[model samples]
Target: MALRMNVQARLDHRFAATYNRFMAAAERRWAYESRGQLLSGLTGRVLEVGAGTGVNIPHYKNADHVVLVEPWPAMRSQLHQKVARDARVATTVVDAVVEDLPFPGASFDAVVCTFVLCSVEDSYAALAEIQRVLRPGGTLAFLEHVRGGWLASRVQDLLTPVIRRFAAGCHPNRDTEGDIERAGFTVLQSETLKPLPVVPWFAPFVKGAASPADHP
Candidate 1:
């Protein structure tokens, strides 16, 4: 367990370093555009998973209450800075992972996940935890880059192992939309976005809304 934790810590450090270098560039060019619209719509008691460097902070205008869950110490450090600078919404940052959230069941009215599902240790378990914490009729909004076309998908598959070494276990080829469906959420709106012309390998995106299917 100690060895595993050490390895994970190294990977987390790498992810923080890499993201800190490129996050600004990506946001200015593409990420902000792809993610901002979805985040702007979030409201009520909102919980955001993998709040990397708090990229969604500026876009959360509608949320009255916000809780950010981020396990990596590096990311959490930056997230703290962002939260401190912004006081638009009451905010709390929790150092925790999605698979084992610290919040009580049925605690949140909405959850926001973006550029997150790709790196979780167990995507299914994370989604299950999201489901468990969300109030009945709660909303889940996500924006993720998923598996691309045939040629690009093969490249993603081949590169995933190497990427995981430094990218915090990100899987570029995950079928995130399908996983969301199987998690027993009724997808309210879903759209497949065209690939970015510059990086076809990281092409193919999905953004949409979903609610618990069994909500009463």
Candidate 2:
């Protein structure tokens, strides 16, 4: 299916600082808690999509080999710091986005995605690509922000225009979990809960393995 998410090139050179600060502030509070849960669930030959600055570094305990994707050039400086001199997550970075993923099909045992679908140009397609590349029964774990209650949903809809402009394509209200379902995976377990501070809406997530593969 052709997706409408590639609306424009929102990843430009101008909003780098704004994105950096926004993410740095987001990390300490609610995000840290949510991300901690997601990372702990990851295991075995994990492939992390959109691993910005390797923020998921410390939580990468289950992995002996971890591959990450981060295409943005602007975030690389901060990302390097997260890479660290001896980080726990032994990381190899992929300089590309989801749609143009560089790995072969059925190449991963697991995939990690956190707070990433909203900014993706075509998140549904990206999920399909993830499902395509992962071995059947491979785990797909995510912690993302998406459309929620009617009140916050309305606010997210209204703010999306301006939010996308200033926040380097971050969207407050994309129905990310819905798209994951459509991509041919069964959600093994999920939870919907709110993060702290002023951030509105619930953080709905799915951490599950897919269907069994057809063997020849």
Every model's TM-score = 0.91, 0.82
**lDDT minimum window of 10 residues, candidate 2:** 207-216
Show the colliding residue pairs in model 2: 53-79
Top model number, lDDT = 1
* Highest TM-score scorer: 1
Off by over 4 Å in 2: 1-15, 18-20, 201-216
What is the per-residue lDDT of model 1 for residues 1-216, given as tens digits with 9 covering 90 to 100? 999889978877877967857667667777787787888877899999999888888888888999999988888999999999974799999999999999899999999999899889788899999999999999999998898888888999999888777788888888898899898999999988874454655668888999988982
**C-alpha-based local distance difference test score of model 1:** 0.86
Give lDDT per model, in order: 0.86, 0.71
Per-residue lDDT value at 196 in model 1: 42
lDDT (C-alpha) at residue 178 in model 1: 88
